[model samples]
Target chain A: MSAQTVADKVDRTDRLGIQQPRLPRLAPLGIAAGAAVLAVLIGVLGGLGSRIQWGLIAAILFVVGLYVISTVVEGGRQAKDRLATSLVWVAFLLAVVPLASLIWETVSKGIKVTDGYFLTHSMSGVVNVAPGGGVYHALMGTIEQVLIATVIATPIGLLTAVYLVEYGRGALAKAVTFFVDVMTGIPSIVAGLFVLSLWIMILDFGYSGFAGALALAILMMPVVVRSTEEMLKLVPNELREASYALGVPKWKTILKVVLPTSIGGITTGVMLAVARITGETAPVLLLVFGSPAINNNPFDGGQASLPLYIYQQWGAGTSASFDRAWAAALVLIVFVMILNLLARGIARWKAPKTGH
Target chain B: MAKRIDISGLTAYYGDFKAIEDISMAVEPRSVTAFIGPSGCGKSTFLRTINRMHEVIPGARVEGKVMLDDENLYGTGVDPVSVRRVVGMVFQRPNPFPTMSVYENVAAGLKLNGRYKKSELDDVVEKSLRGANLWNEVKDRLNRPGSGLSGGQQQRLCIARAIAVEPQVLLMDEPCSALDPISTLAIEDLIGDLKTRFTIVIVTHNMQQAARVSDRTAFFNLSAVGEPGRLIELDDTDKIFSNPSVQATEDYVSGRFG
Candidate 1:
């Protein structure tokens, strides 16, 4: 009945019967270290060329060793449980390894050429094969084009989502939903070609950042609609009913109550869409035609974006160009990272104050 | 302003299935009327028809007349939105607009009607909260989210929001069902005070609650499963509890059967 009695009863039972055994908390760590040593020795003797292979072998041996040792010390069920846990840990490391390596590779290769001078100056007179060029023009073009695309896409996407959630009915809603699904899977290159044919060839507009933006807007819209729709659906029907019972009209209820309630999620979705289109190179290459000199007016002439700049630099196939490409890639990743952080900040600031 | 309700042969349907059968009754102004019924008896559905809240659901329709004082609520040119302004409602569960502060939730209805100066809005919000017996509990935390309040407090906040607009009639569908006994008693006391200014209609599953808080009581019942719920009887609360005119009403009032 009491804590002392329960403990005495358990102690008496343990002394009278066989003891239940468990491995120490640090057992897995010790086993992992042993497995690593064994894997490295096997790799050396077997003449395996890559450390990646050694890591894979180590992960496998660790899981297998954990299962066998746990079975001997504990039981079959505990062994299976440990095996599952180790498998999940190995999978997590597998996922993390590529991402960590990518960031490491970008930082190491890009750090040499990514100074203030590289960010402030443009490649007006510099050739692609030389090492003096910068990414100033590409940064400006990406900022302008992505901003334009977001401005174009967000309202359209938001309204479409509202219609689907609030007032949609019958065949028309289904058709729109089907089309949006279809559009979400459209290849980025196909969007580029569509924009090039329509905006440039038929409309007789020259290659410009605006043309690239049109394609980016096409890609951003469906993602926004999907996420916004999901957020809207999450709003409880009771809130809407409460608003209606207070004599608020449907549109006013949606605008004042529903939209405000889900604004954080909607903003997050829009920011994610913006991030997706920011790194798009296919549309920029086909429509904007990639410029080396800075062009502030996106409507009139060709412009460069970071992704397109990276592609062009890499295509040059020179050591200097390769360095420039790596630096541009790093800059692009940092830009996206900043945007994501800003998105999170906005989400927190705008989130409904439901907690104490 | 309080207004009387006069219904005549009112029938409601959810798609092709009838929810409530043709029934008629009159509810006096400035009095509390409680509707008592078993589960699935359509008491809540009938209450929704007063403000045309019933038709808000897809394929849900109503037939016959609902007269609010001199105006027919189902008149050809009358808008449901305007009708709702005169007939506010409190739902079964407390829903206080999680995005809004307590002050904002109370002022939401007024904001919809028209623009108001800050001082005027503040006065109405205070008056409404006080009217719901919630001003003292929530006055200091007016700027906090309405959802942060206790369950009983949130329901009172919803009541404050409903009364802020000064509706003639206030319908409550089990407003105290989700609350504890103390909170239920608090709301019951508030109902006694509110009946002087608004025509109050409440649907309650608790028979003792109806006997305690209502001036008049109506009993609704269904003949069998899938049958449309029909009004069995309506009478003064004391008489209905002691000596009801209908056999079903007597059976229900005495707790012999539902």
Candidate 2:
């Protein structure tokens, strides 16, 4: 065939063969709106009381409607692709909804009572039925207890992780690995009870934040070890070999090369462990024996922590106490959020400068 | 600082598998000796054995003698760390410590040995980078991360890192295999310059590279698949390429078969 005729035939086939019918760009949004409206109508007609039930119905309808419409317009194969995409989105929203709602509820309700006055004043003289209490004593106790726990756990966890990754070889390594796994699954309350038996029952130590810190340390150690181990394993074997070939001893290589390379990840892990143990109330309740007055010395006497304070305030069953509980809960959330942000900042700061 | 290497009846094993068996050879001081072989022939394994790097692998061991000058590397009471200090190595792909700066990568070995004055470290780093022919390019950006460099520059940086400790012998395992032709040529030139100061043994698959950079060439082969690799021939590079005594060496250099 002539080249011109052949070119024309190719153009006709390209136009006919490649393109397929697709849903409009705004179709998903349109479907979601329709599903929400229909879900509300059904909820009203069926006399469903909760808006949460309406939301769940709308989500299910959105997914089902998208699949049916896409299958009709874009074929079964494209419909399946859209189905997978919508499922992932639904799963993401499912996870995000409760977290967003919790933050929203806390901020809206707690804003009334959480202010500079609430942060700076202690609840020493305030009665549970009346208002005018703050989280000052509890915040101080939480900070000191968590700090002591971090101090106790970090070095032990780091050393254990180093031993596991660098030198762990035979049955001993296997045993240690098994114990770390077991320790990771230990309940926070069990850790509290164990400390209660040892520190309070056996050692005859009085209720103190230090006792609570020991329990928090137990809960935090395995988490730190697990995370640090994963980060250490991520350091390339080639880097170790490189250090070894430099005449550096095994310990020096680990200290200078392996640890430095994974330090960012390790710090982030430790901070996450701290965040996890910060809000643990069972250990604090059993060991520290929540106090109304501020206690500066964690080693000496009873202290109040944020979680324990929240628990006590809610149990009082008064409107003013409920407000204080919500405010304390918000303060706890903000504390955890701050820790997470610090973790991210340290991770970025200490990350290996691999790129410009 | 160059030292002659005398290896006799050397055998290396990984777990229960014999990787290389009964290899014996002598590499002269201040010379470039190239190891050329097909894949899985244990050329790299044999090179690692010279510096006691083979035993770093779990359950991997070596049985034989590798003497540098008068000291036997596998002898009793000889620390592997000190042996590694005397013998430096560059890997196939560039492995500059990702967390270290270019200057720190070169100064890493020096720092491990003992405390060095900052001036001394600067001098050694600059000298080593110059020796690797990387000084002119990286001198201005010595504080930049070694990993930020291009592949060729990173390989050169690794070379500088190896030489900064002033090792008696330098071992390179296919250092140019991961580079483009231009980078390979740059390394070839650097190797030629480096042989004047250190006894260099390099493993490579490229016959042309072997001819271009080496004074002596060792050819390695195995009898069949799953068999332990052995040294087939060691001779002058020109003789190996043109008129090798072994038929297998001739076939390999001429690209007849692996």
Candidate 3:
């Protein structure tokens, strides 16, 4: 029925609307034909001079020809839609061109020095030469420091979230929420400097991986707390009521029913927050004094991480160091990508099955 | 087999604001009583007070004597939890735990308070579902999520959940308001049958429902301008609907004041 109506309307428009028309589609078609003929003539002329620029000129004429034909064959609505669509495609192409170019340039330039030695060796001895360079120590340092940070941050973050969601009542909860909000927007370098001053200047302890972890903890705690708080809030009040109506105590309700219901979302949020802080470089640089060889202890001395390794190698300016830096960057990106995929997978798996 | 409830001089408050004042009533054993009133007239509040569900709302307080089998529920050292265990409630919205299956939803109250053997749980689940008149339709799909059922089934599931712990006094707050006419008739019939075993008190806005399902009816109305709720009459349902004592009850039943 719809198709028949549309066909009848089309017939009516063609028969009745075109009866009083001359060049109903003529002016736009004429202009389009004229431009195409001109583009062909230009191509013929350019064939004698140079054929390369002819491709570029023909592309431009084709676009201009489309604009002319559209304006004539259709009314303002169709013409405007065509114009907007063309412009959108052009804008998309413009964006893709630069992004693709940057990615291509990074991969091509950065892959030259990336090798197995880049993974296994380190910048411990010798000089800034093209032959002796790697990020093995830096990679070890990064992993140990981030693991230490996770240890320091996870309990505090989860506890704070539990308190806020389960027991928080009035002014105290508001105060904690306000502070967490402020902490989320804190500058990374400032957090590093703050932790550095508190431990090194006040307590008079030298730089260690623990200090770097502390700074990263400052950055990570607020994120974990906020995300976990949101996940906890997503748990339905009916679950709490159901538990309470069963004569379960308040603490038990929160622990058994509420936490179990929101566990999936909480895990995803925590992992995402971990991915966020694992790549931090500024605080690590300020608190961790890097070494060429791996130091597993986080509390005693300076350590290196993947971000720090990339920064050091990129700043060193030796060809081999530059290659190691690119390799470290590639590794970090790969780690983040894996974390993202894991987060998505966990979210999908944990989402409650609605129908049984 | 359960005992009766004797409520005297019951008054409810939200913070400092009095909601229902100087109300008193009794629910006999193995009988059904109904509270009927307009919206915000505090019929539901009075119902919640009997089961101590009123305390769930912060700042909600009550001053009253609710004696169930010679024990004063409002007395000091009385755990509201214990009171609620004996006096179960079904809410206006049929809130079966959405995350639980049909069997789990019925078993929630029993499992949460303490541990029960699997054999005991199976017995309780079957009995409760049978008592709510829902066993025949849902017995085969006991593992299905409670939320997947139709609205009427969900309400029956909630009813089954409430009765699973074998509470003596069942307080239903507009249990049939969210149901269809067919479902409402089924619930009304269930209420009539349930009165032979459990003492039941229900709050309902539907006058016809009060007339259809209740043995006794309590008529509630606002006392004065800007004042709290007051009970106008409590009598047999037939007398209350046919020829009430108070002019207020008559006017209300005849759609004058309300």
Q: Fraction of native Cα contacts kept in each candidate? A: 0.73, 0.73, 0.34
- State each model's CA lDDT, in order: 0.95, 0.95, 0.82
Comparing candidate 1 with candidate 2, which one achieves the higher DockQ?
2
Clash number for each model: 0, 0, 1
- Candidate 3 chain A has its poorest 10 consecutive residues by lDDT at A19-28
lDDT accuracy of residue B227 in candidate 2: 93
User: Can you write out model 1's per-residue Cα lDDT over A1-356, one digit (the tens) per residue?
Assistant: 99999998988789767666889999999999999999999999999999999999999999999999999999998899999999999999999999999999999999889999999988899999998989999999999999999999999999999999999989999999999999999999999999999989999999999999999999999999999999999999999899999999999999999999999999999999999999999999999998889999999899999999999999999999999999999999999999999999999998988756
TM-score of chain B of 3: 0.97
Give lDDT for model 2.
Answer: 0.95
Of 1 and 3, which scores higher on DockQ? 1
Q: Write the per-residue lDDT of candidate 2 for residues B45-120, one digit (tens) a residue.
A: 9999999999999999999999999899999999999999999999998998888999999999989777578878
Clashing residue pairs in candidate 1, if any? none
lDDT of 1: 0.95
Q: Is the docking of candidate 3 incorrect, acceptable, medium or high quality?
A: acceptable
Model 3 chain B: which ten-residue window has the lowest total lDDT? B91-100
**In model 2, what lDDT does residue A191 have?**
99
Q: Quick one: best TM-score, which candidate? A: 2
